[model samples]
Target: MLDWLRFGLGTLLMLGGLFVLVTAVLGQFRFRSALNRIHAAALVDTLGILLMLGGLILLAGWSVVSLKLVLVIAFLWLTSPVSSHLLGKLAVTLTDHPEREMQVDDPSLTRDVKEGD
Candidate 1:
């Protein structure tokens, strides 16, 4: 009974993660801007990955592998946003009229940051 429960919950979590990842990919194609696509991709980087790793950890149970999965989740949680921020900044730096899309107070601010002054 307990094993069945674990399998069921793990399967559901994995499927949910796959669904989120697929949706994010579809959203990237559906959205028509770099920032919009990046925003969609970030969903996969965070929630989708978490769900998948959580499912694996559940299946692995109390073990070294599960501990590693937990560590991966923590690392991803720590890094995903920073990477997303850098990507967004890159988009803002490269794209024309990015302030309209990103709601930046001034696009020139991105330039000033890049020039190191």
Candidate 2:
């Protein structure tokens, strides 16, 4: 009974994770800007990974494997956002845009620059 429940839960989580992953991939192509792409990447970092972790935990049952799975999930959750942020920052720094050049005089960019300087 419990085994059946665990299997069912695991399967559901895996399916959900796959679905979110597919959406994230599609979003990368659908979004217009780098910022939008970053957001889509973040969805994969959080939702997709969480679902995968949940599925793994359910599949592994109560064991060291389950504990390790949780640890992996924790590590991913902790690092993915930071990594994504760094990538986004790098992308913004490396890319050139005429509109953004015009916005250099904008208050927000000026404030950000002053803060960094």
* C-alpha TM-score for every candidate: 0.83, 0.80
Q: By TM-score, how accurate is candidate 2? A: 0.80
For model 2, name the residue pairs that clash: none
Compared with the true structure, the alpha-carbon lDDT of candidate 2 equals 0.80
Give candidate 1's root-mean-square deviation (CA, Å): 2.6
**What digit string (tens of lDDT, one per residue) describes model 2 on residues 1-117?**
989998999999999999999999998999777766887878675989899889989998889998998898889989999988877666556555524633344667645633562
| Candidate 1 lDDT trough over 10 residues, lowest sum | 108-117
Which candidate number has the best lDDT?
1
Q: In candidate 1, which residue pairs clash?
A: none
Return the number of clashes found in candidate 1.
0
| Cα lDDT of model 1 by residue, 1-101, tens digit | 99999989999999999999999989989998888998899867699999999999989988999999999999999998899888877876677666566
What is the lDDT of every predicted structure here? 0.85, 0.80
**Candidate 2 Cα misplacement greater than 4 A, ranges:** 98-117
